[model samples]
Each structure stands twice: as C-alpha cells, then as structure tokens.
Target: MEAHHSEIRILKEIAELLNEGTEINGLLSEVLAKLLHVTGLSSGWIFLVEPDGKHMLAAKENLPHALAYNDCEPMCTGDCWCLDRYNNGRLQKATNIIECKRIESALAMKREDTNGLTHHATIPLRAGNEKFGILNVGAPNKTHFEPEELALLESIAFQIGTALKRIKLIEVEQETALTAERNRLARDLHDSVSQLLFSLRLTARGGAEMTADKETKETFTYIQDLAQEALSEMRALIWQLRPRGLENGITSALLDYGQMLGLKVEPEVSGVISLPGKVEEALWRIGQEALANCKKHSGQEKVLLRLSMEAHQVEMLISDCGNGFYYDDKQGEIPTLGLQSMKKRAEHLKGQFKLKSSPDKGTTIQIIIPV
Candidate 1:
C-alpha cells in the first residue's frame, strides 16, 4: 500500500509538470530531472521522433561521462535497440532493454567512463495510436527494472505524450491564424497603400507632362519617379506577405514574380510538383529571396531555376550569369540578409543550403530538403 501511494505521488507531480504549459524541450528536461530525483535514478533522456523517422534528443539529465563525452555526441546520433523497436512498432510499453547500444559502443571504444551503467528501461510515449518517441531512464550499475517501476514510467510517459499532442495542435492552430492575418494584411495593403501609390505616380506623371516651365516639369518628374519607386516597393511587400500565385504552384509563382522584377526566369522542373505544404512554403520563400537577389545584384536580366524531386528529397538550384561578387567559402560568411533568410528557412525544416559565387562568375544557391 505504501509503494502504491508513492507511485501515485510521482504521477501527480509529473502530471502537474506536464500541465505547466512550458515549452516542450524545457518542460521535458525539468520533468526528466524530477523523475530521476523522485525515483532515485541516475540518468534519463527523451527523444522526439518525427513522422519521417528522424529523432531529436530533446532532453537529458545526469548522463555518465562516457555518453556525455564530446557534448553527448553518442546520444545525439546513430541508432539503438529502443529506437529501432519503437520505429518497428515493437515498443508499445515500458520494458527493460537488453543493453544500450550507444553505451556498448562507448565501452568497446575503451573510454571506460560508463560509471557502471549497463542497461536501461525504455518507455514508449504515446497517446492512443499516436506515437511520440521514447523515454529512457537508468542508474549506475542497474541492469534491470521492477515491474511496478516500469508501470510508473509508463504512466508518466502517457502524460508527456498527451502534452506533446496538445502542444502540436496549438502550434498548428497558431500557424493557421498567423497565415490568415498575413493574407488579410496583404489584401489591405493592395487595396489601400498600393492603389494610392499607383494614383500618385499617375498624377505626378500628368503634372510633369502638362507643365510648361522646365523647373516645374523637373520637380514633377522627380515626384513621379519617387512615387513609382514607392509603388514597386509596396508591391514587393504585398507579395512577401501573401504570395499571389502560390495556389498554382511554387514554380509558376516564382516565374511570375521574376517577370514582375523584369527578369527572365528560365525554369527546369523534373518530377511532379507535389510537395508537403510546409516544404512548398519554405521553397517558395527561399526562391523569392534568391530571385530578388539575382535581380538586385546579378547585373543580368536572366536567371536559372532548377527543381528536382526524388523519392526521399527535393532539390532547388538558382543561378545567374551576371557579375557575381567575391564569396570566400573558407570564411563561412553569409554576405547578405537575403542569403541568411534563405539559409534559415531551409534549416528550419532540416534542410541543407549551399551557395557559391565569385567575382564575374555569378552566384548559385542550392537547397536540398528531405520529404
């Protein structure tokens, strides 16, 4: 009866932590630390796995020196029995893993800093049919876990998994709300500021053409030029807020955008244009930045855009034939805000971004994103 009360206390504490509405990573770390303290475990870690089978080490606490070596590189990468079983649908509940492959590898490497740790308990974090990832807890010199201990871990895992689902749903709703707000703003700008600028340009042009005095005409012409520039900038801002032709596809939208900037976009597309919504959005934004850069700096009116899709990944290459500035790859420098934005968009989706350029050789940007 006393042990059962202790288990209930642990569950209540963990449930409170999960309900604290903290960010996922921080919350997981805190909960892991709390679980270890209350259960007298020495170490723990949490993995957040995506639908694509890629996993991230979301949290860890009290790792031994062997696994903690090199910033916990051992835990950060490669596969192990728990993850394999989780992916293969074999890890449905809390169970004792025969051994931790990562620690085993570290032992074989003769680092000899495991702190007497050999095995761990792996609990699958799941809310019904939805599987989030795995929770691993271990202690120094502990090779197995009791049934009641596993049961308690399983209950904690359930709370964590439900919290993850709730957080993800909230994020999706927030993203949807943001996109709607952006579209509304884009429409308002198009109907108000954009139209006002267009009218201003026309009025300035008429004033210039009707004036007889050279000074007055010159003043009017300057006003007209300023208005025209402002109108162009407003249009670019509107496009950025809510891309106009994105419904058709990224390629079509980019081609239209390039033409708007007075550049000829030569596009080569392989495979169908079907892609996940987020992936397509990222690619479109990156393409917009690349094309805008080409128009602003490349000194050429023509740019090359290539898109290829494979079974597991999508690649985009943007290049120009104009005068490219000197880019030193050794310095790992991103020269412009546009390039940085493109790189960030790619990386946010676990993609790769590459750029190449040299004086008089033009610039090339390549992006590869897994599907």
Candidate 2:
C-alpha cells in the first residue's frame, strides 16, 4: 500500500510538471529521476527520435557512474541498439530487453567503466500509432520486474507519450502558422513594396532623360540610381521572405540570390547537399544576412561561399576579399551588421560559428552544424 501510494504521488507530480509547460528536456530529466526513485529502479534514460527517423537524439539519462561515466554511454550517441530496433519497427510496446549490449561490449573489451548491468527493460513511448521514442529503466540488481511493476512502468510510459504527443502537435501547429505568415509577407512584399520600388526607379530614369537643365538631369539621374539600389534591395528582401528556388536546394537558391544582387558568388560544394527543412531555412537566412552584410560594408562585389557536407556534419564558409575590421574594432563588441542574428541561427541548429576580421585582411564567417 505504501509503495502504491508513492507511485501515485510520483504520477501526480509528473502530471503537474507536464501541465505547467516545462520544456521537454527539463521535464524528461526531472520525471525520469522521480520515476526511478518512486519505483525503486536502479537508473533510467530517455531517447527522442528525430524527425528523419534515422537518428534518435539522446534526451536524458540518469545512471550510476560505472555505466554513465564511460565512453560507452556518454550522455548521447548514434550507435544505440535500442534506437536501431525502434527505427526498424521491431519495438512497438513495453518489452524486456534481456541485457544492454553496450555494457556487454564494454565488458568483453575489458573496459574499466563496464557496469554489472546484465538486464534492463525498454518501453516504447507512444501515443496511439504515433511513436515518439523509448523509455528505458534499469533493474535493481538485474532483477526481473513483477507484473504490477511492469503495469506501473507502462502507465508511466503512457503518460510520457501523451505529453510528448501534445508537445509535438503544438510544434507542428506553430510551424504551420509560421510558414503561412512567411508566405503572406512574401506576397505583400512582391505585390506592394517591390512594385512601388520598380515604378519609382522607372519614373526617376524618365525624369532624368527628359530634364533640359544639366544640373536637374544629373540630380534626377542620381535619384534614379538610388531608386535602382532600393529596388534591388527590395527584391533581395522578397526573395528571402519567400524562397522559390529553395525547392531545388539551398545551393541553387543561394546562387539565384547572388545573381539577383548582381554579385558573382561561387559556392564550392562537396558531398550531397541535403538537410532538414528547418535546418535549410536557417542556413538560407544566415547566408542572406552574410551576403547583405558584405554588400553593405565590404565594398567588394564578388565573394566565395563554400558548403561541405560530411558524414555527420555540415560546414559553411563565407569569405570576401574586402576591407575588414581592425584588431581593436568596436564592431565586434557591438554585434554589427546582423552578426548576432547569424550567430543565433547557428546556435539554434546546435552548431559552431566563428568570424575572422583584421585590417587590410579579408573577412570570413564559418559555421558548422552536426547533421
């Protein structure tokens, strides 16, 4: 009766956490530890399956040091047996996985960090047919789970699955709204601002050609040039707001953008350029900002963009042979020319970003994101 009451309390606390809008990561960490404690389980971990279905991102893990501290289980890894089974559609319910292969492998290799974890259980975290990932719990002394314990574990897994499904649905709705807004903005820019700019440029040019006085004509010509520049900038903005060529790929879209800006940007590519839609969108925005910065500050028309895709990562480099900032430049301190935005985009993708600048030297921005 006491154990049952403790389990009920744990479930109530977890439900509160979920209802209170705790982020998935924090919720998982807190709930896993609480569940392990309430159920008297040794340890536990959770995995979140990526949208691609090919990768399972390690969400949270709390375990004894022998299994946790080793290279075999360093928080997260792609080479997980449970994840492989989940991906292959073999695991669809709370099932008993006799032993952790990683521990066995480590023991076989005589690794010092090997644990005496001989058995564990895996519960498929799911809401109806929509599967999220797996909830795994270690057994106390490698003991078997009683029928009641298994039922309780399944109940907790169901709670986790429902929470994850709610979060996933919210994310989907948010993305849908965002995409709709982007389309509307793009349409507005194209139909309104872009047209006005084009009309202004044409009027300015016509006035410049008809004016009899040389001074008046020169002023009109200057206005015409300014209008032309504004029109170009507007087009670039519209392109970014609604990318059409991106349907082909990011490289093609970027090349098209460079052409629109009247600048020759040659992007050297290695390996296949394929990425998740969100990731591609981020890169596009970052690339647009980088190019805009170069045009507004670098005073150079031509630049080099390099994109390299590797086994587990993608790298991007934008370099320009133009006037760069000095060593003691205040620009870096001030986050000038959308550099902060670029950095944020990279960070959002869990990537590394760097910018190099020096007086009389070229500027280069490098970004690396793991796939």
State the TM-score for model 1: 0.96
lDDT of each: 0.91, 0.77
Tens-digit per-residue lDDT, 57-106, candidate 1: 99999899998878889988899999998898888999975589999999
What residue runs in model 2 are displaced by over 4 Å at the alpha carbon? 1-22, 29-144, 213-219, 326-337
* Alpha carbon deviation, residue 174, candidate 2 (Å): 2.0
* Candidate with maximal lDDT: 1
C-alpha RMSD between model 1 and the true structure: 1.5
Off by over 4 Å in 1: none
Cα deviation of 217 in candidate 1 (Å)?
1.3
In candidate 1, residue 183 scores what lDDT?
97
Q: Candidate 2, residue 53: CA error in Å?
A: 11
Question: Per model, how many backbone clashes are there?
Answer: 0, 0
Best by TM-score: 1
